[model samples]
Target: MGESVKYYVLLILRGMAMGAADVVPGVSGGTIAFITGIYEELLDSIRKIGPNTLKALLNEGIPGAWRQCNGAFLASIFGGIAISMVSFARMITWALENHPILVWSFFFGLVAASVVYIFRQLTSVSWREIMALAIGLGLAVFVSVARPVALPDYWWVVMLSGSVAICAMILPGISGSFILLLIGIYPVFIGAIESFNLPLIASFLLGCGVGLLAFSHVLSWLLKHYHNVTLALLTGFLMGSLNVIWPWKQILETTVDRHGEVIPLVQQNILPLTYESLIGLPSQLWPAIGVMFLGLFLVLGLEAISNNMSRCE
Candidate 1:
């Protein structure tokens, strides 16, 4: 592919990866983008739809905003995300249901690879940045470890759930679904999806849309002015997220909400582990290790191809 086309293609692939990550409860596509070094560009490009675009929309309408916002990039990346999520959602749901080990193995690989990719990008890390990374990682790990709970079922509760979940959706390392779970709304949102409850879904999407636009700009500004600090925090987030993706824990029973729908809860360390392990072999731990390596390698492989293409250009 030509250089421009190649770059756009990478963006789409990243979008797909993000879609896959977001499909799971703990992973964030934002984290994948951050690890792959496209997070800032992704945010900046999205943030291009600023005051001018709004003004134009007020005056000349959608077309003006379309032109001002570099609609092609948005169309491509978000389009990729939409396509991947819609197309793969069923398959992913099944895999998580039937073959949890193999599925999480792959994610383990993806995240491991992504961390390496991010680390490689950082030429030097100061203690301050390291501290930021640590903070991010710590927070992510905490989220991963928390127990899931029953959610509220009121309209106002739904609105609040939308706002909070949307924030996690935009931020790297956080899972929107998990955020819903934290707020005790996972079952509520899942019910909306299952029952095709349009009003409920619409309310949630409205919150997501508003949250996404607002958060994207704030993140864009942070990356613009405080690049290293932002990256550090994101790195911490990725590290912390490992707790959620660890593949062998057995789910305890489930809890039902006010609606009496059951949601699974988990307890940790159901499998054997040792310092020495191999790709999903000998035990579940090995597979998790292997998958983590695979994740890391995938990111590095893409980076290598990307860097070579830039050189050729």
Candidate 2:
């Protein structure tokens, strides 16, 4: 017996969800992978994509190399992510620009539910795991609040930022886009994307490939040896990251980009009514809450389906 086509389709859908999450600044594709019940397998698959696969290709042929690299799964997942990022990028960008609070509110619920789901994976709540969770939480908060540091517009710097940000992107709680923002290169990258600068795009993507390969190995090893601590730390990362996506926020400062577009440079979460009063905009409190529940139930529903499938297997 083998996996049905339906299984692969589901995997693609899961990948799409991860892609959608990645498009949001405060959310993570890795967190989406974790909540969708494929975190370990995804890590393992990424870790296996290395030099050995080439040797397998020479010795055992393309199929052998593919098997060694788990090509089918990677292809399905990455393909779906590609499709989704392309399809949803415009829509999400529009939503965030026009309905920022509502958009963030939905993801707020999604990530909140994710914290509970990931925490439930722990078999026990020991002191060591507790410490790990605290550290992860602190790190997430620090990163969320950190001010942007502007680097020179150099190619090597772009590559370095890509490598470092890619590491954060794959981590469960961190946001690669937000990390880029904190690095003060997000707008440049966006400009490149808009202009289709092949050289810059290639540099960044090359960095991403290198970083993903390197970090996946380290993360896979950590999960294998210290599952409890790592899982707990990841759960904490999710908990702390809620600050990044809080629905109501007060903009403390704004900056003008190279394109002359103004964007938030500093912000702090605020209560809904306080946000309305301070920002002089409708908090849309009821609509925000409803969307939050929608996002929450969506994750729960997916988790239930995943659990049922696991039992069937």
Listed per candidate, the RMSD to the true structure in angstroms reads 4.0, 1.7
Give the distance in Å from residue 67's predicted Cα in candidate 2 to where it truly belongs.
0.5
| Model 1 Cα lDDT, one tens digit per residue, 164-196 | 676676677687767777667766666676566
For 1-313, candidate 2 gives per-residue lDDT tens digits of 2667888898899889887877678999898888778889988998988788989999999999999999989888888876786678778888999999899999999889888899999999999999999999999999999987767657888898889888887888898878988888877776676567778877887888889999999999999999999999998888889989998988898988766899889998999999878989999999999999988998899899999989987
Please identify model 2 stretches exceeding 4 Å from their true place: 1-3
Q: Which regions of candidate 1 fall more than 4 Å away from where they truly are?
A: 1-10, 58-63, 153-159, 187-196, 257-262, 273-290, 309-313
List pairs with backbone clashes in candidate 2: none
**lDDT at 199, model 2:** 83
- TM-score, each model? 0.83, 0.95
Score each candidate by Cα lDDT: 0.72, 0.87
